[model samples]
Each structure stands twice: as structure tokens, then as C-alpha cells.
Target: MDLTVKIKRYNPEKDDAPHWESYEVPADPLDSALALLLHVKWHIDGTLSLRKSCAHGICGSDAMQINGENKLACSVLVKDLVDDSGETVTFAPLPSAPVIKDLVIDQSRFFEKYRSVKPWLINDTPEPERERPQSPEEHEIIEDATKCIMCGACTHACPSTWADPDYLGPAAMLKAYRYTFDTRDDGTEERLDIVDSPDGLWKCYTIFNCNQACPKEIDITRWLSALKRRAVTSSASTAA
Candidate 1:
């Protein structure tokens, strides 16, 4: 089958503004959007630039706005986008960030927000000779969050992050939730302090855009609400 791919394109040195560019490419319904893009880059236009690695959905390097939602191009199948009457597939760089080129957005700010949350373990105790142990139940609490490859989809989908560039978006907040809730970690107080601020977890309005945008299918909104509750409880106890 032939698929019509419409990509939102931009080039800083050549284009005054981003524009739509389309290509008709033959593909299997089971073929990935990344495969189609690769075809275009290799055959149609060598100047087309987009980030992709592994091409297997694990790297999260190919996140893009597809069919008006944030998704990893490598994971979304061609058939999943086809409708009864609609035959067009649209690709744009992830929203809420500056576009660097054709279908690529600047992600430096996204990673900076991620680091602000301190995603690593924070146990200050002497290092154990063996790996620190965590119960199965405890590990399950963070299993979904651990699945995050820092794709920036959830963050780009967030309205709060769009409204306030300073807001430490869902990706960072989810990381905070993962570390703050870990039974083996002891950084809850510090992590909560960082997220409970004006531009932190409180900025989230529970709109659930992050839930819809996450290609991993992790219930980011639910976990974020969990973080909000944890923050509130921590504040109450600290006051008492």
C-alpha cells in the first residue's frame, strides 16, 4: 500500500517558517513510520533530518508529533494511523520546544528539567558490597516509571510545561516519583522539596495529556497525582 506522509518541515538557514511537505511512499501496513522516514531520507531527500537510533522503540530517540499526538515514530505502525476515509499520516517535531530542523526539536531544555529532579538513587548510607536489595512489591511501585527512556513525549504534551517554560514537566516529575517512592532510597524530603515548588509538581493540572502522549502506555497522570499527594502529605507532616 502507498501511504501519504505529510511532515512539518523547517530549516533555520533556508526557511523563514516551518512548512508542510508530503511524500508518497509504498509501504506495508506493518511497516513503522521510522521505516518510511528512512526511505524518504535515503531516496527522496537526503536533506531530511530526524533523530533515530535502534529503530526498535527502546531508544526513545524518534519521538515526534504523529497524527496530532506525541509518539515514537519507530513504534507506531502504519496501519494504526489509517482510517476508513483518511489516508494521510502527519509528522511534526514534539511540541512545546523549539524546532532545530526538519522533524527535530531542541531537547536540551527537556533534559535540563530531567536533571533538575535528580533522577538517580539518593541513598547516603555506606555502599553495600552487593547490590542494594528491594522487595518485589517495592520494585513494582516504580516498575512503570522505570520503563521511561526519557523520550520527552510526556513532557512535550503537557500544557503546563507549554505555558511555563520553567515548569519541571511530567518527565521530571515522574522521575521524582520513582526515586521518592523507592523503599531503598532516602531522599524523599529533598526530592519533595524540589517538586513542591511553584514551578514544579504543583503546576500540573491533571489534564491527562501526558497520559495520552506517552507511547510506553504508562499511566503518567496517575503517578503524577500520586506525587502530588505525597508532596501534600510531606508538607503537612513537616508543619506538624
Candidate 2:
């Protein structure tokens, strides 16, 4: 099948703003968005630049704006995207981040926010002589949050992140909840401090775009709700 892929191209050296460039790509029902991009790069525009590590959806490197939503290029099929009128898939860099070139975004701010969360579990006490004892019930609470691949899809789709770039964003907040829910983690109170202020959890507007954008199917809103509840109760309990 022939598919038209309309991509937004930008070059700091040449263009003042991004421009749309469409290409008719030979695609099958099984063709992925990433495959279409590769075809365009190889044939249409040799100057096109983007990021792709694994052709699979797991790497999160190919996350970009497709038809106004953040999604993994490898995960979205071209057949499902195109309309009956032969309208093409629209491609652009993820929102709220600086575009380095045509679909590639500067990830330094994303990574910096991730680091601010102190994503790893921190136990004040020393490790047990053997593995720390834990039950399946205890592990289950944090299981979904751990599925985050740091894709930045959720963050890019988040309205709060777009309004305030300093906001920790959904990915980091989900990571915060992962540890907050962990029975073994004793740092929840301290971690809450990091996300308690304006640029932290309070910035969230509950748009639910993060949950919608998550390829892992993680319930970011539910977890964020839980974190908010915990934060409130913890503060009350501490005051008492």
C-alpha cells in the first residue's frame, strides 16, 4: 500500500521555523511508523535526523508526536494511522522539549528531572545478611510503576510539564510513587518533600494525558492520586 507520511522538518542553520514535508511511502499493513521514517530518511531526505535504538517499542527512543499524541513510532502501525482519503501520519518532536533537529529532541531536561527523583530505592538501614524479606502482596503495589522505561512519552504529553518545564513530569512522579508504595522503602516521607511543592506534585492538573500516552499501560493518574492521598495523610499524621 502507498502511505503518505507528513513530517515536520527543522534545521537551525537554514530554517527559522519547522515546515511540513510529505513523502509517499510504500508500506504494508504491518509497517510501523519507525519503518516509514527510515524509508523517508533513506530515500526522501538524507538530512533527516531522529533517534532509534531498538526497532521494538521497549527502548522508548523513538517516542515522538504522531497526530498530536506522544507515541512510540515502532509501536504504531501505519495502516491504522492513515485515513481513507490517503491522509498521511503527521510527525513532530515531543512537546515541552528542545528539538535538536527533525524529530530528535534534547533529552537533557528529561534526564535531569529523572535524576531529581532519586529513582532508586533507598533504605536507611543496612541490607539484611540475605535478601530482604518481602511478600507478593507488598511487591504488587509497586509493580506497575516499575514498568516505566523512562520513555518521556507521559511527560511530553503532560499539560503541567508543558506549562512548567521545571515540573518533575509524569515519569518521575510515577517513579516517586513506585518507591512511595514500596513496603521496604523508608524514604517516602523524604521523597514526598521533593514532589510536595509547586513544581512537584502540586503542578499536576490531572489531565490524564500521561496515562493515555503510556505504552506500558501504567495507570499514572491512579498512582498520582494515591501519592496525593498519602502526602496529605502523612502531613496530618506528622502534625498530630
Candidate 3:
């Protein structure tokens, strides 16, 4: 199959503003959007630039707006996304982030939000003397949230993040909920504190864009709902 990819390009040094550039390329059933990007860089246009670490979608480097939705370019098959009109792929950097160049955004701000929630396992005890035991029931509580690859798709798709870039966004909130709900974690109180702020959980409007953009199928809204419930219940308990 043949494809026509229209990429929105921006270069502070050259162009006065962002513009679109189209390229025609070959496609196949096994072809990924990332593959088309590489083809563009190699054969169509060498100046086109994008980030991709693991072409298998583990690194989350190639997240971009494909046909209006934030998705991992490495994970989406061109054939699946193409309309009946055939191969016309639209590409752009993740929305709401400063575009560093074509198909690349300054991810520092995104990472900062991720760090604000302290995305890590925090337990009080030292290394387990023997083995840390957790039943499937306990582990299952946070299993969905743990699937996050930090792709920034959820963050990019969020309207709150678009309006207020400082908002921690759904990705970070989900990450916070991951540890907050973990049975082995001892930092639920602190994690809740991190998300209880104005820019944290309170900012989410429950639009569910994060849940829609998640490639891992993580129920971000569900986790966030649970967190909100815990917050309300905890406050009530403390008042009692």
C-alpha cells in the first residue's frame, strides 16, 4: 500500500511559524507509523525529526497525535488507522507541550509533573528479609495503573493540562494512584497530599480523555475515582 503522511513542522530557527509538509511513502500490513516516519527521514526528507527509543512501544518516545489522537507511533498500524480513502496519515507532536521541532516536544515539563507525584515505590521497611508476600487480590488493586509507560498520551490529551500546563495531569495522577493503592506501599498519606492540591486531582474534570488515550487500556478514571473516594472518606474519618 502507498501512504501520504502530512506532518506539522515547526522550527524556531527557520520558519516564522509552524507549517505542514506532506510526504508520499510505501506502506504494508506490518508497517507502523514509526516506520513511515523513518521512511520519511531516510527517503523523503532528512530534516524531519522525531524521537523513538524502542520501536516496540516500551520507551514511550514516539507518542504523537496521529489523525487527531495521541498514540504511540510504534504501536499503531497504518492499515488500521487509514480511512476507506486509503493511506493518508496525519502526524503532529503531542499537543499541549512545547514543540521542540517536528514531531518532538520538550518533555521536561511532562517529566516534572511526573516527578511531582514521586513516581516510585515507597515502602517503610528495608529489603524484604525473605520475600515480600502479596496475594493476587492485593496486587490486583493497582495492577492497572502500573501498566503506564509514561507515554504522555494521557497528559497530552487532557484539556486541563492544555488550559493549565502546571496541572499534574492524568498520567501523573494515575502514577500517584499506583503507589497510593499499593498494598506494600507506606506512602499513601503523602501521595494523597501530592494529589490533593489544586493542580493535582482537583484539576481533573472527569472528561475521561486520559482513559481514551491510554494504549494500555488502564482505567485512569476508575483509579482516580477511587482516590477521590479515599480522600473524601479519609477527611470524614479524621473529622470524626
User: Which prediction has the highest TM-score against the true structure?
Assistant: 1
Model 3 misplacement above 4 A: 84-86
lDDT (Cα, tens digit) per residue for candidate 2, span 45-126: 8899999999888888999998878999998887777754356788999987998899999999989988887788889798
- The candidate with the higher lDDT, 1 or 2, is 1
Which candidate number would show the highest lDDT if scored against the true structure?
1
Model 1 lDDT per residue over 1-240, tens place:
888888899999999999999999888889998988998899899999999998888999999998898999999898888764378888999987999999888999999988888889999899999989999999999999889988999999999988998999999999999999899989999998899899998889999999898889889989999999998888898899
Q: Candidate 3: lDDT of 157?
A: 98
Off by over 4 Å in 2: 83-86
Q: What is the TM-score of each candidate against the true structure?
A: 0.97, 0.96, 0.95
**lDDT score for candidate 1 against the true structure:** 0.91
Displacement of residue 144 (Cα, Å) in model 2 is 1.0
The models' CA-based lDDT, in order, is 0.91, 0.88, 0.88
Backbone clashes in model 1, listed as residue pairs: none
Single out the weakest 10-residue window by summed lDDT for candidate 3: 78-87
**TM-score ranking from best candidate downward:** 1, 2, 3
Error of 1 at 22 (Å): 1.3
Model 3: per-residue Cα lDDT over 9-92, one tens digit each: 998889888899999888886788899999999997899989999899788889999988999999998777785436688999
